[model samples]
Target: MTAEQQTLLEKSYKDFTRNGALLSDEAKEELRKIDAALAVVKLKFGENVLAETQAYQLHLTDAADLSGLPEGTIEAAHDLAKSLDKEGWIFTLDYPSYIPFVTYADKRELRKEIALAAGRKAFQANEHNNEKNVLEIVNLRHQRAQLLGYSSHANFILEERMAQRPEKVNAFLQDLLDKAKPAALKEFQELQDFAKKLDGIEQLEKWDSAYYAEKLKQQKFDLDDEKLKPYFNLAYVLAGAFDVAKQLYGLSFTEVDTIDKYHEDVQTFEVRDENDAFVAIFYADFFPRKGKRNGAWMTSYKPQYWKDGQEERPHVSIVCNFTKPTASRPSLLTFNEVTTLFHEFGHALHGILADTTYPTLSGTSVFWDFVELPSQIMENWCYEEACLANFAKHYETAEVIPMALVDKIKESASFQEGMATLRQISFGLLDMGWHGANPSLIEKVKDFERTQFASTSLYPDVADNAMSTSFSHIFDGGYSSGYYSYKWAEVLDADAFDFFKQEGIFNRAIGEKFKTNILAKGGTEHPMVLYKRFRGQEPRVEPLLKRAGLL
Candidate 1:
């Protein structure tokens, strides 16, 4: 082997040993059993959550109870009820149906009902309760860590992450908490006062938060999502995202009918380089249905790699539970959904442009915190006027979004910056609290979460609702202690985009440098080394703070 290859193999050997390959045969056997059991438990945990989610449905026979919900939401709900041979409207815990009801519905009691139903998923006394599953999962994780001679699960995982150790992750979360607390408190007070004046809301309950926040936002900025959705038809926004990629990377996408798709809702495309060479296969799946989970994300069917003296391309897919089109309208996306599309597409670009050799270390195989930079940075373009002008045209009139509305959108970007930052910091802290130290003492899930979330608490605690029960990120998914990566990557993205702003949003030379240095490099080297080679320096928090209006 070459010297570099030999060195990498040596490091890999050390990694395997440190990760438990060096354990005694008996200990390794125990670990294998623990892993098998834990896998089943984790699968059960996720399935229970989904079952609990699908189990509940609110059937509203009174239009009065549906007051303040948008026309589109009502139509969808009506369609749902009709499909079930029921009357009036039906709203479930699905985000597309649930978010609008909780955010815009004026019926405080019903909103509380919906919110509690959501938060109470897998928490109640039922076949799908996750309380026991959570306890067993954590215990098994701690046992596995101990078998491997690690202090905690976080300590075991952080060894491979940029943060390196739990102490560093703790310090990082604490620092952000310290900075965000003051502003968060102020924002909470203002929101409470606004709620009181607007609706005589006495307590500002958990359910009241989103409803009032939306009202206050509209009152302050004279803007709401419904007013913005008409300009963000899914087809046009997809084209716009593609255009942005083409502008930045000299890539082109052509829809192809021959490519096989796992689902009919999925669209397939052939991606090509500037010289018209085949690059990657892209698949997009939008809209939600039964047997499908909620939310949005990017995934890969095949990894890019070099084998047998040839480079094998990748197949990338982005899946989202966007609002489905109805008889009256196309699938018009909220501004938040627009940014989500850009974020996932950014990850797609990372996969599409991967120029690495090893499949295990290729395309988004970088440190968890560093993996979000490309994705989060793409969100910035959604706010740019030129970017918006390219595709934010009304579906009916074909007129571009008014500059006035764009100004409102930009102005509202940081409307509740303080509260939002604190919410994120709270999640990161909660994650650390769970995984960074001994969690064997956490007897009751809700009580433990209350203690961890004490300082960051904004809304009044609901007796029946708990976040940990449904927090699939740490339990069923890979995030575990790495939820803080979202904030960490925000800092990187904010600083990186500041560079783009200094040059120009679509500057070709700068884009090429970013592509060659960051996007194409993947996990071939240390993430910090690759990042510094791209940015010419370490990232700065000042840029993120400034963009968040927290500075």
Candidate 2:
């Protein structure tokens, strides 16, 4: 058998034994109970978070309360209010509503109100509170890990991941924390000083972070989403993504009308390679509406695999909550949303290019720590002038995006990156705190989180806000003890992109190397081996640090 087949067989056997196939009958029964309970509590945790998000509303009747908001944001809020049969405007805790309010709203008290509301989701004294759920999840996960002969829940989960052990993950995070903390502290002081000078604010609070950061960014770079949105019509940005794919990997995307979609908003496309051979079916749904959750992600309806000497192409989809087009204007995206589109498209490309034999190891069915490499690396293109020149045109004038703005976008890329890195480190630390050690004695979720965040804390803590209560990525989603993978993959992406920059961003030879060794290979080999095959060396942290302006 081939080495890939051997690896798959060994992995399948390990999965069975790790899941308790080798356990005694009595232990198996206990494991079953634990799994069942985990399922119920995880569902409850997510439901409570969603309920809390939908329950709160900041209904505004005064026009002055909307100061500093962009026109599109105001119009969307007005439309929301009209739909709810209210006056003035309405804003919910959804990203489309909440992010804009915190980032751009000039009303300090109002921003604080919404920010606190967002931070307190599922952490309040109400039916939707998730404090108990958080405790139950960690304890149950710990118990299950011990039952499976692992030291901690993180140990059990990490065994199947690139990190492989809790200690390695901890050391990796701590190394990053050590490198980032000093820079983060310096950035925080600068932001505080700027906030005081700009607004005469005495002390910065959790609510002030986004607003002041946006202000400081604008002051430093003269760049803001509102000024750049005109150049990033959603359709144009998407076409730019397709063009990058075509240039990089010789793929084509053609919209089709025959495929049935779950929503009218979903657009279906047929993806093909250079020779006009079918590759994959792509589905894209972009917009916010009732019942649709916030955030963006890529998912697959079918997996690509070779069966009976026939290769089955995959069906992949990207779902995002970009702003909808209003009657007066087309759907213009913020620079952040533009990167998000490319990120998910990168994942779709992974699935589209899969050429593995086994279904289980196809496409994004790779290590938790390595999966983000494709998505995050794609975001680098959004900042590239060569890539942006293709599709970033003004909606009204058809003018290409100004080079000055492109330079600003690249300049601001590392603006407050220190603080950002620290924030991610804090989350990774918090996740490790819950699963890396025994949690049976963890009595209070907020207290536990506070202890975990003590090293990474920036703003003064709000007693009422407990992040773990609403952190569905670990409790309800697949992240679990793997939140650190985001930073881990950043290291890989930075190193990989550096190779492209050395060769050329659009170098077809380098692109084909990436597509063959990284995208098409999937989990056929270990992630590090595949990465090295493409990059010609083990990934480096220097590139990430240098790019983030930490070095």
Candidate 3:
């Protein structure tokens, strides 16, 4: 946390505790001040992140230097070049730039070079390194939670989350690990054997993971991301999202050219209700840059809140680092990227469609476990044929995605899902290892990370590659011990979407039930209560396991 953030958090705690508002004008005023202070903390934190982050970007000149880049990437480079003063191209630390370079770049040494460079963030001997920020954040969080009368940061965050206690979180993570570790080990062994056969490599290095995984995928499934990307262009995917939102709810989006944005690529839109009343403002920042983080997330300029009487519509933004379109071709996406866009947009919908009395109870302000239900449930639509037809058009050919291709997507959906589940469980466990218990003994961070990941190791651990240094989800973002929310939410989303599958994806009654019971209710009730209202029974892991072929 920054100085400003700390100051505000202190004020909020002091004012809230002193006032102790069960109900009164002074109490209301104090609570409002607390709310306003939290808003400031949110904005300043986001601004510092964006400003400090955008304060740097790795630039390159000479078109030949771009030899390792995909053709579409080169075009994005040109776009960045034009934005900056560069003559040839500019690439940022965005995932679009870094991920492709690691997975597909022919230059092995450059891939390792950048891979290590990217991971050392907030820890490297520079201002960009975040070691102090991370440590202070954990300590401050622990302090704040203790003020609220909790033992640690995890206890504070888990109050409303589905995994209500640290013990529950530990049990949930360990149970999944117990199921997934063997499968992950088997998968790693198979990949090692495959790599040895393909290149006579005695040792499988960290850099070799994605490159070989892609090859193994193609050999096993007769399909690869490069082949599927052409069918999942950016524009059609956006249109598909619009269609889904429209069908499920009565919302419509109008692409408006009437507002200011932080970036050139960020297109703005006016969202409306079925009656065409103005609803919300949407912003889409879809390309990578040095100034931006390396993942997709939904943020808000204004939150939907009702105070006294008037309702304030939110300004929601979905930011991601997807591949850029070349002059020769429009922006095409790998299937993973396609699902990511939908997931973030679902978060946007939760914010935009928010109809609540207080900003505190507004969209996605619910329990950590339930928040991802809307987002992840949206991704399930990506695998549906009817959903694909609504978007999924070839940029050049203007043809809908082929049925055969969709079949491949569904068939491969569960491929190596056990390995994937294990990976998530490992991260969740690592998170627990950090905050669910006393991390004060962890004088050195890397040593602690090694113990946490020892059960989940596939490739040899690199001394330079530390997840703690760049783990924005825990260190910087509000996740902390809640990083397990991803897996926890997966259980909820799969079970919730299974309800959707049973009734109908676009069934108005079920959709309304979701909007009313899940999305609209927000933090008013326990997440499981809201979920059981929608699902009729307690959520089970079997649907998730069945989806992942773990069953």
Higher-scoring candidate on TM-score, 2 or 3: 2
Q: For residue 24, give model 2's deviation from the true position in Å.
A: 0.4
In candidate 1, what are the lDDT values of residues 1-551, reduced to their tens digit?
Answer: 74335535755786787657989999988988999999999999999988988888999998899889989899999999999999999999999899999999998989999999999999999889999999898889888888888899898888778888989888888888888888888988999999999888777888988888888899999999989999999999999999999999999999999999888889999999999999999999998899888788889899899999999999999999888889999998889999999999999999999987777767887778889999999999999999999999999999999999999999999888889988998889888888888888889999998998998999888889988888898899889889999999998999999999999999998899899888988777777887888889999999999988888
Clashing pairs in 1: none
Candidates 1 and 2, the one with greater TM-score:
2
Model 3 scores what on Cα lDDT? 0.76
List the candidate 2 regions with Cα displacement exceeding 4 Å: none
lDDT tens per residue, model 3, 260-377? 9888889899999899998899999997755566688999888888767888988999998887666678789989999999999989998988876667667777767778888998
lDDT of 3 at 514: 84
Candidate 1 to native Cα RMSD, angstroms: 1.4
Question: Arrange candidates by TM-score, highest first: which order?
Answer: 2, 1, 3
Error of 1 at 326 (Å): 0.7
What is the lDDT for 283 in model 3? 96
What range of 10 consecutive residues in model 2 has the weakest lDDT sum?
287-296
Question: Cα lDDT for residue 307, model 2?
Answer: 90
